[model samples]
Target: MAVHHQASIVPTKAELLAAWVPRQPWAAGADTSSLTKLGSYRFDDPDGEVGMETHVLATADGQVLQVPLTYRGAPRAGAEESLVTTMTHTTLGDRWIYDALHDPVYAAVLASTIATGGHEADLFLSTPDGLVLQPASARVRGSGTAPSAPAAGWSGPRVTVAGTTSRIECDGALLTVLHVLETTTASAAADELVLTGTWLGQDRPVLLAVLR
Candidate 1:
């Protein structure tokens, strides 16, 4: 038998968020064009080749936002529009930065990490090639339909509630909520969560939630 191996590259906490925050649509003060990082942490990826980073940034106007960034070797095919921004890592040298949400492989890794404690429901989207589902560990209290198939060109996963629908996507270490019908009603609550891993240079716990 033969074994294959690959090199791993990880970025520092500052480097991770510095490359991440400005790209987010929800990022406040983004339009002003100046950014200052307040704090940051990392999410665990057992395979170090992929790096997940969470950052707290302060805008010139004093608004703060949490941004998560995932670093990958290459860009996902056909997702150039979803690509947020690209920058070089100081420690890693010349590798390119990629947004994880657009990449199915990284999404699977994130979903698997989240699905550890609870049972994974089968409400995922399917393609002729395979199925892509968001990993949910909470108990489904009521009956609801699964999400619709992923859309083409900058479309994200569909999550429905009552008669309304929303789109969910992950970017790097941060999860993005879009097309929300009602903002007040959309939220995430977890019983208990832990920060058991680290990415970039910060520590990350499993209970992290991105609420709209």
Candidate 2:
């Protein structure tokens, strides 16, 4: 289970995005005037070292952007390029946040989750007295395209973007991380894995990621 902290965060998640999202080349047209967080999902690390969370932000213009982040106690070595920001947490202390794609641990869990058809981990809030269950945002699920060994680079190590979609080329499969989700139906091809997100009252399946 992923325990959520009810303690204060130095810089709120929205504040960090306001400073970092504008710098992204793909978010050029994004309306940074306001960033409303839609919801977030979590993945657990088998080693229990890194904290993985993927946040989806909605712009004023109805654009949905996905930003996966990995929190580390210390600075991630050799990931200076992918570092977003660092902040002090009342419960966890200092944390280094980096783009999930640049973190090997995030990639491994993400790939494995997709290949094995996994769901988001259960989350509970850590309180002063004890742990309390919190309402999760939405449901997130994944399915693997090509069934194979879920290794570290099963979905490639480096990241590249094609238009609004991000692409990661692995040894035998290609993974696509959809940055901007569209409501239109997506044509399915043979041997493809897709991750979807859903919210209350909204039954539309938003394609979050794909692997083929």
TM of each candidate vs. truth: 0.45, 0.90
Report the error of model 1 at residue 2, Å.
26
Residue range 1-212, candidate 2, lDDT tens digits: 78888778979887898888777776777776778888888888888888998888888888878888899999977889999999899989999989886677776776667777887888888878998887778667776544653654542376786777777666655667777777555445656777887755447877888766
Residue 27, model 1: lDDT of 52
Best by lDDT: 2
Candidate 1 Cα misplacement greater than 4 A, ranges: 1-24, 28-32, 89-91, 113-212
| lDDT, model 2 | 0.77
lDDT of 1 at 11: 55
| lDDT (tens digit, per residue) of candidate 1 on 34-149 | 55564444444545565554444556565444444566656656767555555554444545455544555444443443434322223344445565653322221211122421
lDDT of each: 0.39, 0.77
**Residue-level error in angstroms, candidate 1, position 88:** 4.0
Query: Which has the greatest TM-score?
Result: 2
Backbone atom clashes (below 3 Å) for every candidate: 8, 0
